[model samples]
Target: MKFLKQFGIILGVSFIGEVLKYFIPLPIPASIYGLVIMLLLLSVKIVSVEQVKDTGSYLIEIMPVMFIPAAVGLITMWSELKSLWFPLCVITVVTTVIVMAAAGRVTQFIIRMEKRQKE
Candidate 1:
C-alpha cells in the first residue's frame, strides 16, 4: 500500500538516474545524481516529504550496512595500505581539510546570496 508507493517512487527516481548516468558524461556518481533529482522534486513540491519519509528513514537506518563492503575491501588492502600509510594519511588529512574549507566557503556564499535576495 503506502510502503509500496514509497518504494515505487524511490525505484523510479533511481532508475531515471541510472538511465541519465548511462547517457550523460558526468564524473559524479549516479546515486548522487539521483539524490539531486529527488531533492529538486521535493523542493518543487512535485513529491511531498510525507510520501518519501518512510523510505528515506529506512535507507538512512541501513546506511551503515552499505559501508560494510567498502570496509572489507579496505581491510583486504591492508598490506598494500601499510606500505603507503604515511603518504595516504597525509593525503587523506589534506584532502579533508581542503574539502571542509571549500564547503564552508560555499555555504557562506549561498547564505549571503540568500540574504541579499531577501533584502
Candidate 2:
C-alpha cells in the first residue's frame, strides 16, 4: 500500500508534466518537467523524501532495464548508423571528456568551498 501510494504520487506528477507539455509550447520533454516538479515538491517539504525514497530507489534499480529497448532499437538501426559511426564516435568522446572536466572542476570548487567554511 505504501509503494502504491508513492508510485501514485510519481505518476500523478508525471501526468501533470505531460499535461503541461501538451498545453505549453515549450520544447522540453515531459519527463524533465516531472523531475523539476518532483524536486520542487521535495525542496519545499510538500513531499517528504521518505514518502518517495523507496519507490524512487526501486525505479533506479530497474533503470538499466529501461535502456534495453533503446539498445535494441539502436541495433536494429545499425545499418543506418554505420555510415555516421566515425563522427558519432568522435562526438561521444569529445562530449564525454568535456563533461568529465566540467564535473571535476565543479567538484573541486565545491570541496574548496566546504574547506573554507570549516576554517
Each prediction's whole-model lDDT (CA): 0.94, 0.97
Q: Tell how far residue 100 is off in model 2, in angstroms.
A: 2.7
TM-score of 1: 0.84
Ten-residue segment with the worst summed lDDT in candidate 2?
A: 16-25
TM-scores for the candidates: 0.84, 0.86
Model 1: residue 64 alpha-carbon error in angstroms: 1.3
Off by over 4 Å in 1: none
lDDT of 1: 0.94
- Identify the leading candidate in terms of lDDT: 2
Model 2, which residues run further than 4 Å from truth? 108-119
Error of 2 at 85 (Å): 0.8
Task: Give lDDT tens digits, candidate 2, residues 12-102.
Answer: 9999999989988999999999999999999999999999999999999999999999999999999999999999999999999999999
lDDT of 2 at 68: 100
On the 0 to 100 scale, the lDDT of residue 93 in model 2 is 100
Clashing pairs in 2: none
